[model samples]
Target: MSRSTCVPTSEPALVVAVDGPSGSGKSSVSRAVARRFGLRYLDTGAMYRALTWWCLEQGVDLTDPAAVVDAMDAMPLEMGTDPAAPSVRVGSVDVGQAIRQTRVSEQVSAVATNLQVRARMRDLQRRLIHEASEGIVAEGRDITTVVAPDADVRVLLTATELTRLQRRALELHGHAEESAVAATRDQVVRRDRDDSTVSQFVTAADGVRTIDSSSMTFEQVVDALTELVGSRTGRVPRAGSA
Candidate 1:
């Protein structure tokens, strides 16, 4: 938690790559860290979800990898990088919220697990990262390994299974009651299990920092990442500011 003495007076290009399992708060924490450092944010998972939503809309068979790849090639997707209000748009339709639907959650893993789909996404993600003006915080299952292995900072944020289930249940159902948690099992557990087939997110790879956030509040996790970023990049803010 100590600040670097060589902290730079002004911000520099810094790409922070974070990967984690479902409900591990990767997206939210990454966004918070990006906002703290005046950086862009990228939710790589949203790309997959957007693709899934598009595939479903186009009636592309999820089980057919070739068909899904065709759909992926034809899909027109746009991603907004602002951490404060990031968005996903497919063609003229805004799917920022639609991609988070239960139906999409249930099938996104199918598309994500496709090797061709992952390859295409990796290329696109790398392009976005390279084009980020001020730098970016990109989070997803394989970001730390595949998408941005050379990111300035890499973190694997994770939590206990019970905690992950409760958190996801709260997000999806507005409550973490037993019933809600039970209902969310498939979305958190099953989706993660399926997606893991293509990405290694359950554990941190070499040189990546591991942050077990089950006991940390959202603000605490954000602070931890922000501090890590400052330490790694020496791009610290003035004392007492951000």
Candidate 2:
């Protein structure tokens, strides 16, 4: 198969931006790509999850957009940008595990959909992307179009609906049975519908390369992105095939 090339750049730092729907393998692919390129990794979803955790802890109503935005405005969130050791700490609580709970999964969209919250997140994300001294791999719903459109490499990683549902079921339930998939439908499908309202990830933006990973293994996806990057950087080093 022919490979796509990233735009050539001399900017001191190379930013690789990837956007995709949930369960499309973008997170795993982006992390693997970051490991390969030795770039800092940023998981933008974790930020919203942490905020959701915060709102629930503070007893803020999810229906009140103004309250949500105010809490997020003062939210003391420290997001670790290293993909190798990605961490999320809300105040004194290390919520890396807490934020991934089903509770946060169900309610995060309420906070993420707040236009003010998104604006604040966009500012923070841009600053984080710029601060990655040795380049970074940032992935989320809007990184390619909204957050880092000028990234050295912008990719839209995607997978089919059935494939995405099955993958998410496996991740959440350790099995991809019908029961598991049914349980995961709302988390993956409903959230995607709600997130699409504020950010576009279901389709690639103009000039953004789209990698459909429906039939690709995790390693294959990583390798494809690496090749895409290498094409621009010229004879780039592989990220170690361990």
Q: What is the TM-score of each candidate against the true structure?
A: 0.93, 0.93
Model 2, 150-190: lDDT tens digits are 98899999999999999999999999999999999999999
- Show pairs that collide, candidate 2: 36-239
Clashes of each: 0, 1
lDDT string for model 1 (70-158, tens) is 99999999999999899999999999999999899999999999999999999999999989978999999999999999999999999
CA shift of 32, model 1, Å:
0.7
Candidate 2's displacement at residue 183, Å, is: 0.5
Q: Which parts of model 2 have CA positions greater than 4 angstroms off?
A: 1-11, 238-241
Return the top candidate by lDDT. Answer: 1
* Residue 145 displacement in candidate 2 (angstroms): 0.5
RMSD of each: 5.9, 6.9
| Model 1 misplaced stretches (Cα beyond 4 Å) | 1-12, 238-242
